[model samples]
Target: MIASSWLLVAFPALGALILLVGGRRTDAWGHLLGCATVIASFGYAVAMFVSSSLAEATDVALYSWIPVDALQVEFGLRIDPLSMTFVLLITGVGALIHVYSIGYMADDAGRRRFFGYLNLFVASMLVLVLGNSFVTLYLGWEGVGLASYLLIGWYTGRPSAATAAKKAFLMNRVGDVGLALAIFLMFSEIGSTSYAAVFAGIGDLSPAVITAIALLLLLGACGKSGQFPLQAWLPDAMEGPTPVSALIHAATMVTAGVYLVARAAPIYNLTETGRLLVTIVGAFTLLLGAIIGCAYDDIKKVLAYSTVSQIGYMMLAVGLGPFGYALGIMHLLTHGFFKAGLFLGAGSVMHGMNDEVDMRKFGGLYKRMPITFATFGLGYLALIGFPFLSGFYSKDAIIEAAFGSEGWQGWVFGGAAMLGAGITGFYMTRLVLMTFFGKERWRELKSADGREFHPHESPPVMTVPMIVLAVGSVGAGFFFALGDRLVEFLAPSVGALSEAEHTALPHALIPWLTVGLSLFGALVAWLIFGRRDVPVERPQNVSPVTRAARNDLYGNALNEALVATPGLWTTRFAVYLDNKGVDGAVNGLAAALGGSSGRLRRLQTGFVRSYALSMLGGSFLIVAALLMVRFS
Candidate 1:
């Protein structure tokens, strides 16, 4: 089993290498290998999850990788409920996304490169989830960042893709700085960087230092998870392939932040101030993302903002401390299923329409593509936290935790989250109605230039993944029955933090009320847009404020001013100083010495006669002085 754990990660890497070496000439093999690798890995994850659930604790530790007098780190794999859950998420959702990409990138010229990067991403994510220590985790962390950079810039010829990649890389670096600082603090405080050592040392550290470390880790989480201020890159990340967006933005990479916080629950549990900061940041980001998502017109952009919002909810639950860990992890699992399905469904629509992404251009697509529309529509409902769906169970859990007897602050944050849910429902309905319920708006399809275009269903390869994910999106929540088992499984690694009591609110009432609120939101959208008999008004038809919101609320401009401008100015300033200040000083000193030598050059100008006379005069003066001294 220990060796098999390594194989789970190695398989995808092997697939990637094979595709890189052999798939350049034949993409069929590339897709086949990529799909097969993820499926096999997913099979292993499932087997582990079931076996670990049924049997006693199952962990496989390899030989020590880091050994010191005071500290030791081993290369090991844990099959606890936490790691098992994430493994399923990575491999199951990842496998479907890989399979879907086969159809999504069918006509692309660089399909081989695409699959290669995709396989690499899956492998790195596996490394991240499987690692037993911070050092092993960091290896996967940096690996994912590298893969993201490549995949984001897959369309290197497009300026937007390049720009988005650079933005993501730089923003993540800002967060990574904090992560690095936290690692240093951990090593200094505990004398080790292993997860076991750090958790074990939590009680020995000062509360202030603990808070600082947690906050630093939170900063890094914010960057990876697409929280506010650092979140601007995700929307623009749609510049990559649709499958890339589905996999990284929706399913896996962005969720790393939540995983990081959950894995380090012990550190945050030690400090009240740290918990407060996490809650505040999480709440703020949730509301901010929901607000921004309400105004986006692009299909993928809307989903991107939703990803940010969903992660915010996860952070909120995690911030509630050890008690919320189960909630956070549960949401992570369900979110993966639903969001990945939605993004892929959207990708299928794009594929059918020849890559049109604007919601305004589509209408009444249900008749044209029933499977795509039904799956996407259902996915939207799941995201709105409607009753009985996977999202409802997880999201309601967070809201319930927020409203517990802790303080009004939790209640306030929870209330705001509830409002965000309604807004989520409203905007999703607006998207669905605008794109699929009204009259067909793209008359160009009937025109001479558009005659060649015909709406068609995605191939079975794509639909199969969508169907599987949709099923999971609808049903994965029932796994929460194993919550206690989960806690026990992770206790050795994550340790115990004060467990939060489940909310006192009746569970039966919560889902119904939230769903009612969501329905009201959907009704508003239906009334405002769905019933329109003629072409809807343009964005300008709305108020200037609404127009601004539709334009990402000028978040892009603020990002340029706050992040881009300063970064460029600093870089340019450093370049100038190196060229003009430091180099110029050395060159200036040499020039000055040369000038002084030139000024004194006349004295040495080939004057042999003058030299001889001066020597004779000096000799006479010396002889006269000596004679005078003798006479005296």
Candidate 2:
């Protein structure tokens, strides 16, 4: 079964090929085929997980991909506990998203193309996780970037969608450069890009080299996972269809960063500076996401920011070195369940509300869409770390681990995690209240077409998946955390927790402190939103802080000032140089030659007498010059 692991990626790759090349011939049942492919992959993943021996990692080499003197790279798959975990999450959640898209895109003329892109995304992400070497993983990394661009711009008719796609592609490329450089360094120093070889030789590398490699990998991770400085593209990605949001932002694409860090634990463990940087990045990004999440009116954008924050937690967990690698991944799995459900539930809301996304305009929808409300409510609870929920088990563990660190690092990271939890509760509770609990703002206001608003439940095709994911959101943590099974399963890949001397926080206080802050956040949100009326019209007069958050805390501004403006100016300068310097030099020389040739053309007068006279004059001048020289 491990030897045939290539089938996992092949299933969806074939689906994409058929749906795309078959064209209109596949439109009738293309979506169903897409769903089937992912489900089949999920089934295979489950079978492999149950039957494969967990004690040893299996490497399946499909072929030698690149061979040169002293350099060999194989197209292979690594079947281990870590890769298997991601395989199940990707295919399982992906299958659900595919099913949800059937109803979500049923009316669109390009639904077949959409399904094809979804399959391509699944195949690409599978390759990223299963690849046994960095080179192979980079192949999948580029594939995912391409697939995301296509999916995000699915409605190419919308300028915003097209722009969003371009932004995501370009930003991801920036991080990709770091990953590429890191691989080059590996080959330069270690003479191979294969994971086995690289890990085996990691000890021979200097601390400086290891730190450089770790940081480069983190750069790539930040770009994919929507961490600080590269996070602006994520919320705008909401311009894509909600199903795309559910699949990419919630379950698979964004989590790739966490997977990258966890997979590179051998490198991270070697340098304290590298590990501390990861912690700092994670700590900063989680707060950044949580703060921004509080100011969004768009339901999907809110969830998008929430995703940024949740992934930050994962980053923070894995950044804790051995203590948090398994914990981070554990949260990632649980997050996949609830976050995907939340995004799908948002889709269901948009489906019934005539595709409205503003939470300000949504109110009293519980009665109209009970299934969506129930499923979304469960996911919301899980996201907020409600007692015994999946997040409760996973998120709280991370918080406890943060505090378990020795000194000020623990205090700082633990504080950030705690504050982020509270802000998460506040913003998510705000979303729930505005969208479902208040008076129907729809009844008072008209839609874009000036028609009265009508809300209803989505078809069973969509709601059923939401319900299924909701169950996972409620139960997956308990299952994974019961015996620390997730930790034990991942120990082989990440190594067991270290017994290094550190000042550990009191374990009893962490969970209570986290939950108490969360409740306080929820209370504040209810007081501000639930007790008061939410205005349907966008509020103009607001505090400066709210305005800043609405503007993404000047994130885009900073990018524009530091990156976009500089880039634009550099491009303009290059164009100027090309026109005035390069082109000018060529054209100037051509003009001079043309002008001189034109004057010289007079010497070629068609008149024979004139030509003879010119020749005689030239001969006389030459004779006179020779005579003068001889006389001298």
Instruction: State the number of backbone clashes in model 1.
Output: 1
**Model 1 error, position 354 (Å):** 0.9
Model 1 lDDT per residue over 161-279, tens place: 99999988888888888888998898888888877678878889888899899999988888888886688877878889889999997667899988899888878878878877777
Where does model 1 exceed 4 Å of error? 21-28, 53-59, 63-73, 445-453, 479-500, 503-508, 533-538, 599-604, 610-632
lDDT for model 1: 0.80
Candidates in order have lDDT scores of 0.80, 0.93
Model 2, position 468: C-alpha lDDT score = 97
Mark the 10 consecutive residues where model 1 has the least summed lDDT.
Answer: 497-506
User: What does candidate 2's lDDT look like per residue over 1-632, in tens digits?
Assistant: 88889999999999999999997989999999999999999999999999989676778999998888777998999998999999999999999999999999999999998999999999999999999999999999999999999989888899999999999999998899989999999999999998899999999999999999999999999999999879999888899999999999877889999999999999999988888988998999999999999998999999999999999999999998887899999999999999999999999999999888999999999999999999999999999999999999999889989988778988999999999999999999999999999888988887787766789999999999999999999999999998778888898888876445123434667977899999899999999999989988889898999999999999999999999999999999999999999999999999999999999987886999998898899999999999999999
lDDT accuracy of residue 77 in candidate 1: 67
TM-score of 2: 0.97
Candidate 2 Cα lDDT to native: 0.93
